[model samples]
Target: MLAKLILRNLLHHWGSTLLSMILLSTGVGIISLLLAVNKQVEDKFNRDLKNIDLVVGAKGSPLQLVLSAVYHLDAPTGNISKEEAEKLLTNPMIEQVTPLAYGDNYDGFRIVGTDSTYLLKYNSSFSRGSMFSNPMEVVAGSNVAKKKELKIGSSFTGTHGLSKDSDDDHEHFKYVVKGILNPTGSVLDNLILTPVESVERVHSERHEHAEHEQHEEGHDEDKTTGKQITALLLTFRSPQAMFSLPRFINESTNMQSASPTLEINRLLGLLGIGMDSVKAVAATLLLVAGLSIFIALYSRLSEKKYELALIRSLGCSRMKLFTLVVSEAILLCLAGFAGGMLLGITGMYWLNEKAADEYSFTLITNNLWNKDQFLLLTGTILIGITAALIPSVKAYRLNISKTLANA
Candidate 1:
């Protein structure tokens, strides 16, 4: 009976109730969306950064080097000579050096040329077939296999560049899907991995073919540079190497080394500023919603005093009148909370689709409710109760005879 009365009262003042609900939902939705995106992005970054201490690549922005070499989110600065990178393997402080060569793509998925160490580092295992052991043999990531419908022994020629739109297909050499990897929820999930020699072989042949064509035209130009890999993922034996190695490589060698941890932290710090601003806006909206609820209830209490008094005369307790007033506010906030959750979930779904399409990345959406969202629910309920308190008190203390005579 109390709930029905609260519902009817809210329906009678539908315009103001809707306005408050919209404000609350918008605020909650924005905060919830940020929480989901931030958590997933940070988790993905930290997951991929595991086992990788340093990234040695061509001289450029350290952050870009990390983004490109470690995360495969951006174009590599440039290629570093394989011979030059191999020199780091001799260092006593270095534990593992995984060479990465990026030059081609299949259906928008990057083809990374690295040895089995790359898979081992991510603890990846075959979903179906065996790992690639020979040149031109490739292992497809789970997403690549599913999206492109690549089966074991399937053959596809890569486009000459990183993008699927590149028309320069390497028709001379084709890659066979030797294996498909189980999803590791890391950067490897979208990559096509092959032996480093395969990438070197393809580009080497392309360079040779171009040179031969030029030679035939009698315009001989030396365009050949020795084998180059895009970057090297380095793991150090000791923490001391972190201080000296990146500086040595940046200062002494043509290549630049970047620490994934440092770069990612810096990136998060920059992102935090934008997130904080949005949080402030959401907070402001919530405050406005609370104020709106307060004003609406306070004004409505004045109009409903006679009705409240008549109910009191009919033996309704003072506490029940107070409960009735507060219940209305709680009902509106509950509706707003439900709408907000739906809005946030829809926003996250859209964001995941956009991220996957644009960056070949997707945010984790499995757990929609977390501690922060629970706190949001608690805070919302508190706001409802607080906003209706004064109005409820007025209802509780109403003079039935005086209100009835005034009416």
Candidate 2:
């Protein structure tokens, strides 16, 4: 009977009830979506940074170097000579060094030039065929093969720049798809792998072609330099190397070194500022929602006083009247929470689709249950209960004789 009464009251004041729910739901949905995206980005970086110590690249921003070399999400600073990078590999403190050479792309997916060790870093294995053994031979990442419809022995020419829209095509240098890699859900899953020499060869040819064109046009061409690698991903043999190696390289050499841990934290700190602003907006919305609930219940008390008094006169307890109002508030809160969760879920699906297509960064879609989410839900319920308390108290203290006389 109490549930029926509460339902009727809410239905009769459907405009106010729906307005309150819309405000609450919009707040909750924004917060939930932020949480999911932040968590997924952190997870993706942590997964991809496994077993890496420092990135050595041409002198520029450390963050850019890390983002380009480690995450493969941005353009490289510039290229450093292979000879200069090899010297770092010869450092006694260095355990491993994998050279990266990248300057071209196929359909917006980057082509990375590295060795077999790059495959081992991501725990990737051949899904078909064998690793590239010759210049211009390439191995396709799982996502690249699936999306680009590449197979063993298939050939594709690369565009000159990192973006798919590059007008400069390397038509003469066709890369054969020598292998396809198993999906490891890391940065490697979006790249096309080839020998570093292949990248140097293609760019060298490009340079020669440009020079030839300049000569034909009676323009002066600058002197060309040696073959260059984009960056070197290094692992150290000892903790002592962290203390000295990156500092020494930055101070003495033309190459700059960036720590994965420091740069990633710096990136997150910048992201936090934007996220905090969003959270503040959501909190403000929630506060407005609380105020709306309080108004809805308080304004209805005068109109419902007679009905409430008659129910009390007919043997309905004062506590029952209080419970009815409170129940209505609780129901609205729960309904809003459910709607918000659905909205958040839809946002997550959209993010997953974009991430997968662009970066091959697959977010864990199932792990939505967490302590923070629970706390948010609990806090919202408390807000509803608190808003309903004052109105419920007024209903409980009603004078049956006075209310009926006024009516």
Model 1: which residue pairs collide? Answer: none
TM-score for candidate 1, please give it.
0.95
List TM-score per model, in order.
Answer: 0.95, 0.93
Judge candidate 1 against the unseen true structure and give its global Cα lDDT, from 0 to 1. Answer: 0.91
**Stretches > 4 Å off in candidate 1:** 211-221
User: Best candidate per TM-score, number?
Assistant: 1
Best by lDDT: 1
Give the C-alpha miss distance for residue 33 in model 2, angstroms. Answer: 0.6
How much lDDT does each candidate structure score?
A: 0.91, 0.89
Tens-digit lDDT track of model 1 for 115-185: 98899889999999998999999999999999899999999999888777889888989999999999999
Candidate 2 local lDDT, 313-365, one digit each (tens): 99999898889889999999888888777778887788778766666576666
Ten-residue segment with the worst summed lDDT in candidate 1? 357-366
How many backbone clashes are present in model 1?
0
